[model samples]
Target: MNKCYIDGSIGQCGHSSRSADKAAASGTVMDLKKDFHMNSGAGDNSYARNSKIQGLIISKSQSERRKAAVAAYLGTGRPATMSVADLGCSSGPTALLAVEDIMVAVERACVELHGQPPEFNLLLNDLYGNDFNALFRSFPEFNSRRQGKGLCFVTGVPGTFYGRLFAAKSLHLVCSSSSLHWLSQMPEELQQKEGSPAACVNKGKVFISAGSPPCVAEAYRKQFHRDFTTFLRCRAEEIVRGGLMVLAFMSRKNREAALMEDRYIWGLLEDALNAMASEERIDSFDAPFYAPSMEELEEEIGGEGSFCIRSSDQFLVRWDDDNQYSGTGGEANVTARPVKHAVRMAKGVRAVAESMLRSHFGEGFGMDDLFCRYGGLLAQYYADSEAAVTNVVISLVRK
Candidate 1:
């Protein structure tokens, strides 16, 4: 719903908020757009309150983002008004948290160059159903933090990242954190009917577990390949030559690490559901998520033929790591107090995944019962294995 035109007709990115809300409420909303957003407000269970892990991912990627600002400033010769976008910027404090870092970096860079800082035309992009209202409400807080930084005009662009959301050569820099693993929708192969020979019926599991057929994993890889390739191509067109991008997402070092993550994260959901209901829900459900290897990403970028990698990193985030903001538990907390860890992990999972789970099962599904089981599973998963998830952040410059 962004007023941005692919033919390069320019307008103020100002109308995006009003248009975003309208599109979100439309009767013809896409399946994933309607159910893919995080919990919308600042309540106890809201994404704003429970997204500490996502915030940490952003924090961990600070150096890359900082590097990006300077690289983009220099690469593009420091235009007077730089246009930047944050894709899949779901509604939360962390959303603006990313922008703040970029702003400070650019401002500092300008100072270092002994030049006037460029004003920013900042765009926040997400699916139609994203809670842009909450983001606007929190804008003042972000504005308060912008003292002495360049001017910023922030707006929302509502749409999926699978396709074009901006005009050609319209962007100077782009960034997304903790978002790329999500497939645009369920893989076409997995959605086939249960008894069909071609269907990936994932019999007793909800995701790619250790016992999954090789076909299931292949389906995931194929979808990620398709989606990520399309993503690079679209961004290539929108970004000015030499513009930079910083993307941070859940990733795997290889297939072995992939299974280890699946076992710890989605595996807990599988165990909880199996214990709560029969195998019926488990068999019928599949998470629309895939964590790719760094090689997989490199291959796609190379094939896309638009951007060259500048830098890449693999950061390991511990499951038991305690976050003061989230009140979530880590190894030390698990030993001192276990119940908090369960609550932490369960609430965090529910914040992001509950919407899709409820939509798949039923609106009236027992969230309490399921998450309770999920918490118990988390405690046990930690007791059994050294749990951590791999996150990869890559910096690229448009060719």
Candidate 2:
């Protein structure tokens, strides 16, 4: 994990591998340190890879809905000075698409502004440990796109949007996608059930049971609540009297029967580990993590004093053949199981599996292979299962 953190140059500005090398040499593990998490090392390029394959499909759809919501919130003859922020902005390539979208929206909104569009301030906020390398690599293109416009790019400020990444009453437009689900912290109390003797075997493994306790489940829910409510209040403080916010994120369904089960990808990965346990392959497996459902989000945000739902919906994204498991369709069998789990695990939770493969499995294990296998397994899972469609976007706005 330290090596992976070192390899990605996590938690710095720009794509200079020098920072990562220096950190590696210094033996500094930023991901495990006091103030840093969400580094590309911790999160991996999953979002980057998924964006290329998905191409703002759900995000763009949610963006369109958000555009309408923003327009409706602002109405006609809106002010000229507008500022927007994309919280949890990952790499440059993924972040750039939304910038382009926002620019187009600004231009379109300007036509109604009687010739002058709002002087827009677009902020890209993410953890300091993010992969700015990709962003720096694409800087030239971004500058060229804003040749004559007054757009600004800034980095590393206070607040974890999970809490409050910005100041009060300060923004006209704020956008985030596929990011809000991450909790500020993981649960510490949930131990594996007694049937699990392997739970006592290794200190390295801090495992959770397949059937998580109410407190464990509620921990994530409460974290989202605390982070989101504070986020809304902070945005409310920064937003003008009637400014707008456009948010799109992965949301689950609210029904018990229809609710996504562990058989779903996240849970299934944990289950697969449990399967390995039955075969005594490993001691125990930890449960998977996920974002809130649309209902949960709406309920949480609506209950918060600062925001009201302008518009929100759930939509599906089907898997396409082009985004299939690499050039081959399930040609790789034994290696297939680890592919999806590995990529999902890239955010740096399950380190033991990663280490074993590289040092013990003799399988030439690396990040790329882990990511590809992850993507392929996901593609295959979506292909085979009937209930495994990707979460739909939940669009929201400030009251």
Candidate 3:
């Protein structure tokens, strides 16, 4: 399996490669049948694994919701045999969890279908760059689970989910979690905007200042819309009629909230990078794409014709902190430092941000600075013990 797909054509959410004729990177929108080579970018499944851990530590609500969505779909007059796909299956941890939850849900739904459970074909897909070795590491366990129940098959197929990786109307349910934010590679135009608003930054943070030229902002927004819409269209084709898809990902709040609080996080990163650069710890700077606000996400979804939104919910991630603080003012509001367990928690946050940074900037840039700065910001943000509702989960059924 190729890890990343390099094609500049912006599909849905600007992630999938529609054509490799142009320059690009992993997660481009294209016909599943189209001949193309896979790269390692999509194969970076560590984040997916980390996400699974984070999901458990932060929010299990979505897991329950996803299970219910599958059950609801099966309750319909669908066939006993169902095909399911996990778009960004990555290594196997998260994939397995999602598949198991789905299977469990299907089994519960089958109470009304008949006495026996539904025969299922579950496809676990990731970019070719994925660690197939690690992914297969769990196969023994998966096979063991298969012996006692309904006929079931699980396979690892490497590819981006942006395109139609499955047969048209072949999938009964599709679930992609914490993925789908990547647009088709990076925009060539955005890439070339060296000194423009699209590339503006202050205090090592990346942001569009009020002085940013309108064209750069518009260009970026256009690219995002085009890519996001294409993503929906491709997924629409892969889902069977009446099929259900529950996708959960990071999303920002309103512009005001994003700028005053969220934008500062990026700035904190800039401060970190500047510190690193000043100390010669790193050579350059890069910024990652982030969770779109509810408004932005809704706008994109509303424009797409492929799926109908059934339910949308926003929730806060429960930071794994006890709300302890130290110092008078400097670190006074910060969550009293994490424990040994926080070693993993800290790494997980760094991993997601690193992925975004590498995609935007290039390699050779370390995230230590970014991590430190954002760590403080996050600690401070959660200091008041306020509910940090920063994520949005949306469930959709094929139109």
Candidate 4:
């Protein structure tokens, strides 16, 4: 177990005044490899079961993904064997969907140019603790469905995408969906400040929100800038010239990070925690996440100078789009009831955040109670407003 600093003496921000002293007293380094991952298995709380929202994200980016694959194959003169990678491919049915989409695009390009499809080497990457076993269980079905049309080999590579995960000029195409918004780690400057009135700099919040201090937003922005730059630099070294990358992740339309819909979800969660008298549990717990604007993303890519943007677009996603609690009566009636909406929201949030919550709050914290409160909060919020979340999808080519 990693050492947790939730003793009210430390903060979630990485740069507390007494951070040096605290670190010296307890030698612990944040290990994202061990910390980050979707909840494992096909259980009710598992990411695999509740990732329909991510699937929707993948569906929306299909055109971009296909275009990138085709461009990559044609640009490379239809390599006999194409190398492809999906970074942050968490465990779920959707894990292999991107691979399949790429295969279809490449195969179509091959038929249009050559007579047949090229052999494919597909790599699925995620954090080390990801539920890869469950991910692999779907491969046989995937292979069988392929019907021997193309010789494709699928493998899992566990590690952070913020660093180099493949050899130099080894990859022809790279894609990521519903990821990248996740920072490699929390911003070091956001750590809890000693002798501060509040336990954390970003009090009562796990992520940047309208209520967050300007310094909190700046910290997140800096962390994202650094991490995204490193990500592009690493990919630039690994991808061959003319290779393509399609990235689709959550983003805010507004320049101000606090006004984003994504941050409101965390605000609601914070409310739930506070209601449970466990606000202190999240005192030193900053979520390693950020939803960048299109401008921010373009700036990073341009500054990196390794890739040129081919196309970019933003889309809105409603929270109730994938409501699983719809009864046989009708969609409108089901969504009208607060309980059903709350249940769906709870499951979706729990799937992605259970690991982080568990790690930060420890086992003694009542997960059921916390999510119940969260669900109620979500219910009330949705009852009053029907806002949609925003996401940006960008296609790029190595220069």
- The number of the candidate with the highest lDDT is 4
Predicted candidate 3, C-alpha RMSD: 10.4
Order candidates by TM-score, high to low.
4, 1, 3, 2
lDDT of each: 0.76, 0.48, 0.53, 0.78
The candidate scoring highest on TM-score is 4
TM-score of 1: 0.87
Report how far residue 384 has shifted in candidate 4, in Å.
Answer: 2.2
Better of 1 and 2 by TM-score: 1
RMSD vs true structure, all candidates: 11.2, 9.6, 10.4, 7.3
- State the TM-score for model 4: 0.88
In order of appearance, the predictions have TM-scores of 0.87, 0.66, 0.70, 0.88
Query: Model 2: per-residue lDDT, tens digit, 46-88?
Result: 3453343234443546566447534733652365666677776
- lDDT: which is higher, 3 or 4? 4
Q: Residues 1-399, candidate 4, lDDT per residue (tens digit)?
A: 111112111112221121122212121334667866888999878898888878888988899899989999888777889999999999888899888999998888777765678899999999998999999998888889899588998889999998889999999999999989988887878765455444368777777866778888889999999999999999999999999999999998988776666676788887666554344545566788899999989899999899999999999876556654444577667455554555666777788887766666654556666676676666677766654678999999999
The clash numbers for all candidates, in the given order, read: 1, 15, 38, 8
Clashing pairs for predicted structure model 1, backbone only: 320-330
Q: Write the per-residue lDDT of candidate 1 for residues 88-200, one digit (tens) a residue.
A: 89887788877778888998888887999999999999988788999888888887877656689988999989999999999999999988989887766776453566443
For residue 287, model 1's alpha carbon misses the true position, in angstroms, by: 0.6
Error of 3 at 160 (Å): 2.6
**What would the per-residue lDDT of candidate 3 be over residues 105-217, giving only the tens digit for each residue?**
77766675565677888888766656667767778887787667677777777766656677777778877766665545433344424354543322232443333345534
